[model samples]
Target: MKRARGRGPLSTVVGIVLLALMLFPVYWMVNASLQPAGSTLRGGWFPLHPDFGGYAVALREQGRNLLTSLLVSLGSVVLGLGLAAPAAHALARFPLRGTRAVLLAVLVTQMVPGIVVADALYDAYAGLGLLDSYLGLVLADSTAGVPFAIIILHAFMRTIPGEIIEAARMDGAGRLRVFRSVVLPLSTNALVTAAVFTFLFSWSDFLFALTLTSTPSVRPITLGIYEYLGAHTDQWNAVMATSVLASLPAALLLVLSQRFVTAGATSGALR
Candidate 1:
């Protein structure tokens, strides 16, 4: 019908508008980063002649921390998912007494403010001589990231029926074997989703990294960006440029693994 056709076009226009609104800040950041300081802001909608100098400054001046941030994010994703997957598998298949309560406890732990635990964590890290270290940040980020990974992967694991697992067991596979063979393949989508989520959390975390790591040697890019801003307050161009650069890895990660996200969201909708 004409009405249906018109509705489809209108819906598409609305969706495109919404997407533009959401991406406007990113577009502006990229645009601003391409322009010389104050050039884009000097009464223009976009750069007259876009340049890559901001990106150059961001790389040469701040690339080291970007690498460190990538390491931190990737490390947290691998470690968090490693620890969470088995626990999620167990929680999904053999959920025990008080499991819901424990899940509630895990979710509740996430709600606690970072400031509330900062002092205690600082003291603990200092006692362990982990102050201003990557290990310390990794541990902190893992603690923060685990609960979400567990909840998310557990939900995805539940989407897989128990019969497949039981069949693996019947074929003389042990629990661990069954998990490796039957569950892991189907749950790759969840793993990617959890990794992406965990990476984002660890990548963007400022409070923990800033409080834990005192030096640029181990601090992630988020903290580096803050330091960049503090030291270059008058250099808004460099600051924005650094911010735009900082977001690239996560953006690339999402783009690269978007297929997993689609599969996980559609077929693995957590029960």
Candidate 2:
């Protein structure tokens, strides 16, 4: 048998260097968070004497914002999936008219600049008394999640064998039953993919949060961090500490669900 080949030394070195460059900022953020001064400008390369005071201050100051973010993100996931999954299923399985146009419109919406959506939603939301509210934020964030989830779920649903669906229908299952029992179970990977990304999108949303809210009520962590950047310019460690905390959920989720994400994303591709 032939021996297993390894990457060339030069390529390995290049990859290592590139990785270091990409990850340097993250390491620096953690480093700054550990510094007693929380000052990046004067921070040492290593935390010879680490300080977690920054985290204490972050928890004390921004805890409510973090919780608000979680609630809004979760709400977005629920609303987004509720809307996306069915639309995707109909588009993929049904021979509805203008299906292609609707899909195209979805793609176009993604291309529309976020600032434009925020601007338009501001007046409409204000008129509806949704300003500075969790519902408003969830609705706005769902714009991003719903479209993305539709595209992902559509692609994955298209890969479901036609015979399986027909068999389910023949067994006295109506359309809704077929969808709930047949389609959803087979689409687990895609559902997880959509849910994970939806959560991430809503979790990281800033444009809607910034535009729609003028009050201290329902502040997500992104807005909290932005205001903190200005309000606590001297306390870089606390800011960085909050950054680390915010990064944790998304990072952990992505790492844990990487396999499902990759599988779902690539499921419909033909060989």
Candidate 3:
């Protein structure tokens, strides 16, 4: 027990060193954004006289695109959960034939390259008139979100005991009611987990956003940053400022959603 009490000091120091190495780039990105002007990272390690000019330009130019990304990500989350929850519940509870095959297919879809999916979607979307529209992006993003959510939701829901589900049924609750009142309420963590991951996937998506949208009218923030690479390379501060703005939402979501994945604990002990 004493041996398992904590890691040794050397191990802790090693871990901290690795963590700092990983975070150095993020620190540099923030540091670069504050500089008034820099063709390269000659702004030193600290910004004594921080300039807000880059942030000003980012907000004025990319604010609308940022809002567009937020809208599409949220839409993908709702649409993904709406489909995945019921399907995952059914897959978890029912002993339907070919369940393993279906799960395998879902996993296989993840292995398929995003570029291929984007190309196929482009052709279908062009005929269906979904190009360069909010609905189009939402639907495209959900192709990733829905499958991933199903995998996450299914893994969690499977842990729910059959006895609890039976108790709900014995009390005269319909299948839908039991799902709504009991299973869903107890699986709150899984639902939130799935939603958060789905949101992040849709948020950071560049391929589908790049392929599906042509006009600037429905551009996401990722595309906005791509524009900075060409048009504003000389303005590196603005470019970094745009990157910082883009990373803020995903970072905040990850920080705010505290994941407590209890291993094989009973539902009563969850809270």
Question: For candidate 2, lDDT tens digit of each residue in 31-78?
Answer: 999998645888899999999999999999989999999999999999
lDDT of 1: 0.83
The numbered model that scores best in lDDT is: 2
In model 3, the number of clashes is 0
Per-residue lDDT tens digits of candidate 3, residues 82-118? 9999999999899899998999998899888999999
Better of 1 and 3 by TM-score: 3
TM-score of each: 0.90, 0.95, 0.92
lDDT sort, best first: 2, 3, 1
Against the reference, the lDDT scores of all candidates come to 0.83, 0.93, 0.87
lDDT of 2: 0.93
lDDT of 1 by residue, 173-221 (tens): 9998988888989899888888888999899888888678887678788
Clashes of each: 0, 0, 0
Off by over 4 Å in 3: 1-7, 260-271
Give every collision pair in model 1: none
| Angstrom error at residue 262, model 3 | 7.7
